[model samples]
Target: MSKRIFVGYATKTGSTKETAEAIAKTLSGRGFGVDVKPFAQAGDLGAYDGFVLGAPVNGMAWHPDASAFVRANASTLAAKPTAYFLLSLAYGVGRASMKRAIPARLAPSSALAKPVATACFGGVIATEPPIVLRLLFGIKKGSPRDSRNWDDIHAFAEGLAAKLAPR
Candidate 1:
């Protein structure tokens, strides 16, 4: 039977969704049957053999929907070969910048199921928000940058695929 992989993500302005799609594509290229869905639309995690849960980091916290999905399906996830990835500005610059943005608290835990691997990738910042939203939040014009490292993402997906390969 083909391994079933589900990539569920919560995105505000589409960055996280893009990352999830990319991951699904990579896994599909590696021969796994992959499903990429928005966290709100994802249903029945128990059907998949493996899962990749991801979200964009906002205000130093993960999106509530993404976190809730994992929490709600914690048991089913714990039983499978699961993995997690994050998208943030951290992965863009040097280690110091990455470190400051990606915190240990954000990493997947055994409580959420011992994922085969976890990753933090860089993300984008858009400039189309309303002025009030930007000013109230003290948001500045962040440079358009994609800190996503495709090589690392591919390697991680491949590694997970190998681990979940049929015995």
Candidate 2:
């Protein structure tokens, strides 16, 4: 039987969900049974063999919903082959310091489950900044830009599949 994997994500906008979908598609293509869902609807994790958890980076930290999920499921996650991915403008549109903060920001999640892999992807900004951006960065308006690198995203998923492949 193919291994079952859960791809659960939280998004302030929708970039993280989109990234999670892409990850799920790649994992499915590589012969795994993948289920994609939002963090709030992550039911019965024990039914899955592995996990791919993702969330957006906001206010220089992992989204609270994803962090809370990690905290709540740390025990189950630590016992499974798990990976994490984050989406953020820091990926391609921010200063080096912001980019440098990604690992530190991800430390909380990794400290819990010690994932097999972790990735950070560039995020998409809509024509109007989302509330999170306005509240966090005080950006009231902006041009839309999609900075996601499909090659990097696909590669991250492929590499994660390799790491989590059964013996």
Candidate 2, residue 158: how far the Cα is off, in Å? 0.6
Q: Tens digits of per-residue lDDT for model 1 on 1-167?
A: 67988888888889888778877888888889988998777777767888888887776566677678878888888788777777765444334633465645355443576766777776676544455544543334453456577887777767777765532
lDDT of 2 by residue, 2-33 (tens): 99999999987788888899999999999999
**How high is the lDDT of residue 18 in model 1?**
79
The runs of at least 3 residues in candidate 2 whose Cα sits more than 4 Å from the true structure, single-residue gaps closed, are 128-144
Question: Which ten residues in a row are the worst by lDDT in model 2?
Answer: 135-144
* Candidate 1 runs further than 4 Å off: 94-103, 108-110, 128-144
lDDT per model, in order?
A: 0.72, 0.84
TM-score of each: 0.80, 0.88
